[model samples]
Target chain A: MVTYIWVFFVIVGSFFTIFTGNVEALNNEILKGGADGLKLLSEMLPLLVLWTGIMQVAEDSKILELFSNLVRPFLCKLFPSLPKNHPALGYIASNICANALGLGSAATPFGLKAMECLQEDNPCKDTATEAMITFLVLNTGGVTIVPTTVIALRLMHGSANPSEIIITSILATLCSNVSGLIYDYFKRRKKHG
Target chain B: MANFLVPIFVLGIILYAFKQKVNIYESFLVGAKDGLVTTFKIAPAVIAMVFATNIFLNSHFLDFVFSYFTPFLEAVGIPNSILPMAMVRPISGTASLAIMSNIFELYGPDSFVGRLASNLQGCTDTTIYVLALYFSSIKVTKTKHALSAGLFADFVGIVAAFIITFLFFG
Candidate 1:
């Protein structure tokens, strides 16, 4: 899917630029894009390192487990197919908590771990299960409360009220999450009904 | 208030770790090392995405596409510069962030467009990227309804971001 999108971008972008007589700008972007990518990577590197390190403390100290226990009952209601004490639930809980706090780098590890656990019990190795689909929906909806990265960028740009959008972001993401879950629930019901 | 949230959260994690009798320094180093490996692993994807998105943006196709909606957008109070950001947001986070930053630079962050960009950025994750990565990690080729649900969520998020921003800051 992403393959098609990437190709579309490259082909259509080039054609459009040529047709629009912006071949010069196209040339510049193509020449500079790789460097831009690297620069972006560098900027993200330190933050990822620091947050993952802190998150590791959260994991090793069993804080994640405690957090998971706190959220497990609610999560079990969402992912009913899973066992009551599945390890995947713990990972999923940690992932969601990290994501809500806007620690995306930290969330990826737990997310991958959650997938690994889910794959262990998956009936079809090549197909996603209903629980997996539900998890993906919740994950993609991104119930972020802080949006730390956006605020950081706003601060970098010297915004007078860098964090002003936090409440609005939370509200918007809540709407996304609720609607996505509702859609997923109905689809799941239709599939296995 | 929001500015203090992250610092307080980080401190709480650290304090909790200490209370748990965890070796905070060693654990951090281990996780940080893993983070480095993960960064290297995802760098190729990030680079590829950035290269493609940069070309797409440089082509000004979004401007051409959005030109038709300029009058309507103006009437609705949506900035013309934000159309691409909202559209590309669920496809790529880095690309969206770049656009948000551009909006901030063009119109100060307090500006309505800047607030909209920030709300848009926080409204959803990169659906395609997350789906691709998570599914491939487990070798799941048949994604079923995950894509549709995720994209649906993104659509809702985008609309919600716009409406919420207008209500709050417009």
Candidate 2:
């Protein structure tokens, strides 16, 4: 799926640029594209390292166990396919908690771990399960509470009220999450019913 | 308020680790090393995403497409400047962030456009990127309903961002 999209972008973009007589600019952009990837990697590297380390501590200290236990009931309701005390639920809870706190980089490892756990139980190795899809929906909806990065960017850009968007962000994310979950619920029902 | 969250979180982790008799330093190193490996694992996908997204964005196709919607957006109280950000947001996080920071620099963060940009940025994760990374990590090539559902969420999030921004900051 991503393969098709990736190819579409490169092929269609190049063709469009050629037709628009921006072929030279497109040439420059294609080169810059790879460099931009490296730039992004550099930017994400430190944050990923720091958060994963902290998350590792949380895991070792059983902090994740505590956190997951706190959210387990709710997660069980959301992911009924999984067993009540499944390890994936713990990872999923940790992922959601990290996302809520706006620790996106920290959330990735937990999410990946959750996926790995889900895969362990998946009968079909190549296909995603209903539980996996539901988790993806929730993860993509994001449901961030603080939006720390946005606030920080605003502050850096000299906004008079850097955190003003926080409330709106939370509200908007809630709306997205609700709508996404509702959609997923109905779709799942249709599949089973 | 947002500033204290990370510090407090770290402190909480440290205190909890101490009480649990966990060697925080060793655990952290182990996790950090895993993180570096994860980074490498995802680097190829990330690079491909960035490269392709940049090519598409640089093609200015979105700009061309959005030009037609400018007047309608303005009429609906949405700023024309943010359309591109909203469009590419689900595809690439860094691209949207760059657009958002540009909006911040140009209009200042207190402006309506700025607030909308911030809300858009916060409302969702990069759906395509997340799907690619997570699925690839597990080697799940058949994504089933995940992509459609994730994009649906992003669509709703974008609309919610626009509407909520207007209600709050318009």
Candidate 3:
């Protein structure tokens, strides 16, 4: 799946730019791609490190277990295949909590940890499990409540009420999450049937 | 609120951990080491995805495709200027952010388009990027329905953003 997407990007992007008479920019991006990736990594690593460290404390102290226990009912419904208090559940809860707060990058470490825990139970190393897919659906659906980045940007741009769209953002995010979950549910049913 | 959430959350975790008699500093170092290892582990995948995505974005393919649909979209109250942001959103967050900033610059952040862009930014995550990163990190080559489901959610999010924006700000 990733193979096809990368190929499509390279082939289509190069051809389109060349045909559009902007080969220069495409050349620049291709060359700068790796550096940009590194720059992004450097920027992201700090938060991931900090959160992973902090969450590690949370995990070690069994704080995560307590937290996950609180949310187990809701998470169990979303991830029915997993045991009642799977280790991944705590990480999943942490990831969801971080994500919902709009600490977008800060959420990645917990999410990565969640994936690692989920992978432990994955029978086939190279294939995604249903639980993994469901978790990804929840993660990528962006169930943000504050939209700190957007609000901050608006604040920078001198808006009268930068956070006014908080309600609207929440509504839209709810729609996305609900819709994604519904789609995932249907696909799960079909696979079983 | 986000400003305070981090400190409060961190304090809560620390307090809990301390009460639990956990070796906080040692555990933190161990986890931080794991974080570093994991960061480097995924660096290659990050580079690969970023390379392809940057190429795609720099090509301005969405601009070309959206140009053809601008008239129709604008006729329905969707600003042509915001199309690139919406299209690039699920693909690349920074690209959408750049476009959103441009929109704010061009037509003040208080405008309907600006509000719509704000909603759009909040409504969906970068589905393609997140999918690639997560699955590739685990070396999962066969992602059956993750892509479709994530993109489906993004599509719904975009539409919802439009409706919610119009309802609230328009």
Candidate 4:
């Protein structure tokens, strides 16, 4: 509810600014920005295909399963309702894997599949399940090591050292993931308690 | 070179393990098929999001917001170059990528703002798009709480990115 309100304000605010002609420079900005965006996307294709192929190989070889097993103990602690071998675990692993590589497009299927698998065990038709809540937390704060997408954008923009942001990216993701996990923990505790 | 070699070695080991047991090519093809299907399913929403971002940006509204939020952003250690990104981050990844590229072009990659903007781009997401698509696909009718929670997470991401960048690059 409050979120919608904030969005409404943001929209109205942006429009108000536009109406005041405060953004007349945007015409040229968009023209330049769009071209650059397309170029970046083009350059990103090879990397995206490479990572997608690697992820496919990972899935085919059950390396994803292996990864899931490694994370299962911690995930189980976070999401008690999810059974030991729930399909959502695989989807979650894939989603996390794609995200770590900074492949947001590639992460979508895995996220959707994870949610679907979670829905299987959701007793309440309307309320989000514990698994769903936890998955949301993980998705929102998923660790991103390479941040390939951003690096690609940097490369497109002619950044000399596109990879320099790797350390900061990792740190920020770690913080977000930790905070998300902590928030979920207390939220769940409060709900049950 | 070592950075590039590591990933190749990892892939090679995985392939070697699967040799003679499973048809690696066939399995990969199957997975690719699934990937293509998922891509198509989400294409419409992604396109709509891209279009919306284009409109918002072209309308010049984002610039105004950036100006308005300049002081607050600076207070948080975010440079002006990264401000456009902060505005676009919640709108569309593609649009944000475009903005990022422009920044990189105007200011070389090593420039503080360019680097920070690029990093922040990776760290955050198109929160509105994610909320709409994820909730809709799952038939989530009332998105009140989810929206609030997701945006709150995005806010944290923005602040975290600024702080991390400042600490590491400042």
- Best candidate, lDDT-wise? 3
Q: What is the C-alpha local distance difference test score of candidate 1?
A: 0.85
Off by over 4 Å in 4: A1-63, A156-160, B1-44, B70-81
Best-fitting candidate, scored by DockQ: 3
lDDT of 1 at B71: 96
Which 10-residue window in model 1 chain A sums to the lowest lDDT?
A104-113
Stretches of model 3 off by over 4 angstroms after superposition:
none
User: Which digits, one per residue and each the tens of the lDDT, describe model 2 over residues B1-170?
Assistant: 65677799899999999998998999999989977887787788778888888888888888888999989988987667798999888987778999999998888899889999999999999888889888877778888778888888888898999889889878
TM-score of chain B of each: 0.70, 0.85, 0.95, 0.69
lDDT of 4 by residue, A81-151 (tens): 77888767877877777678776756766787677677777676656666676677667664788887677
Please state the interface RMSD for every predicted structure, separated by commas.
Answer: 3.4, 2.1, 0.9, 5.5
What is candidate 4's DockQ?
0.32
Candidate 3, residues A68-97, lDDT tens digits: the string is 999999999999999997999999998898
Off by over 4 Å in 1: A23-60, A153-162, B1-43, B105-107, B137-139
Q: What iRMS does model 3 reach?
A: 0.9
lDDT of 3 by residue, B1-170 (tens): 57999999899999999998999999999999889988998999899889998888888888888889978987887778787898889888999999999999988889999999999999999998898898888889999999999999999999999988888888
Candidate 2 or 1, higher DockQ? 2
Listing candidates in order, what is each one's chain A TM-score?
Answer: 0.77, 0.87, 0.97, 0.71
Extract clashing residue pairs from model 4: A159-B109
| Chain A TM-score (model 1) | 0.77
| CA shift of B170, model 2, Å | 3.0
What ranking emerges by TM-score with the best candidate at the front?
3, 2, 1, 4
